[model samples]
Target: MPGSITGTIVDPTGATVAGARVRISHRDQSAEQEALSGDDGQYSLPNVTPGPFQLTITLVGFTTQASSGILRSGENYTVPQIAMPLATAVTEVRVVPSRVEVAEDQIKAQEKQRVLGVVPNFYVSYDHHAVPLAPKQKFELAWKTTVDPVSFGVTGAIAGIQQAQNDFSGYGQGAQGYGKRFGASYANFLASTYIGGAILPSLLKQDPRYFYKGAGSKRSRVLYAIANSVICKGDNGHWQANYSSILGSLAAGGISNLYYPAKNRDGAELTFENTLIGISESAAVNLLQEFFIRKLTRNIPNYEPVSP
Candidate 1:
């Protein structure tokens, strides 16, 4: 059934905000409608089909506000007066994050990302033009990733596989062997994540998160997925060599020699070869992120395109 939505727009200070863009969308349907607030800051979205709906309000210099609710059949739903928050700072070209605050918010949203509502996939960004993380935030993401229960479970599973296959025979067999393999596996994950995903990325001023390519042709996206393994976006928003990932892979592989069996420890040649393999695996994973993971991730924000 058809219904109507009406609301008044106000700034954080309670002043009426006129000329703000209001976008109303149906949650279960691919339908959207737009309206502009009037001089009195009042707007009406009449003849809206009843269902779950979301309303987004946008104005220059204000943080976007999103409101959602169920609209009953033939009912007029009057939402509370929408008061949009002011952006921390704004320039002629675009809005910049307020110091670390914006990045913190973005990070919080990213942290909630999980594949199929369980597996942690926090390193991918659904927003292509996301803000850069501050140094502290980078470490925070690494710590969070390392401490997640799922991460521990995965490491344990890898240890079980290795024990069953006797892949790392140096660790031997049985419960003690499983413990050794588990520790080694977790150490690898910790080192690589901190090095490639946090430490190096911080020092090099590069973003470690895989930016989702939701637009463009399939060929272009495939190229992007492959290229990201060797190239990354800097904090300045420019593309550059991905030394973080490359060097981190080498460093992690080299460090493993200290713990792995003598036979498994590769010389310099094998280290480089393993690094290359790691990069290849990263490309494959990024391709999955670009093409499939998002559909499985829960709690993803309805990210809109921002000016690059």
Candidate 2:
């Protein structure tokens, strides 16, 4: 025989837990019952015959509970107070970071590194796909390099070397000749850099900076960088003829005739020839940049292969 069982459920705060499911069961040949707690957390299994029985309670996001006890026939069973512990909470967090953006930031930092800490060396890209600089950025680079204190120092040194070598004897000797040589050399640097690196690059939609290909077989990378002297990335991001560099060399050479001694003047044919010499000189410099400059450069970020 069996009797009735009843009970209430509550949280630690003593709030009534409504809608909690309760189960009453007996062993083999047993019966079962279910009910939701009322506002008072009270529930009952009505008209149950007395016998050994099991009680269970369950809720979502909470642990399940059960107990067993005996009930005598025609008796009423009052269950002990039921308390459920709060379920443990699980939290998750995710983070995504930008590698390309970080690389660009590093390049900006390296742009400040200068030869002997004064000459601007802003044109080398330490990362692939280094963002294309705006026209203003191109002009800014040329301006800074042209006006650098070290630029003036190097110009003076070169004039001294030429004076010693008597390379441009046409300019004569003594202080006047040295002044003329210095002015001519500096002017040549200014005209060529501004025209090639800023003015013509802006007008012709070309990028004046060198894109370093630091990978591939030695021969391939060498060829790629050398070819860049003649073929450049345009502002459109495509490789095209380097007309900016070519025309800039010619313009600088032609302008030089104005300052060189009259006896050393290159007629139209000689001006064009000197322009070709400038292009070849650029090719040699580009080769050094690809093969050697990175080793001497101090502030470049350590090279890391990009992930696929």
- Top candidate when judged by lDDT against the true structure: 1
List the global CA lDDT of all models. Answer: 0.86, 0.74
In the range 97-183, model 2's lDDT, one tens digit per residue, is 233344346446657766455555677765544445667777877887788787899999999998999867898899988998999
Model 2 poorest 10 in a row by lDDT: 91-100
Clashes of each: 0, 5
**Worst lDDT 10-window in candidate 1:** 90-99
Angstrom error of the Cα, residue 192, model 1: value is 0.3
Cα distance off (Å), candidate 1, residue 255: 0.6
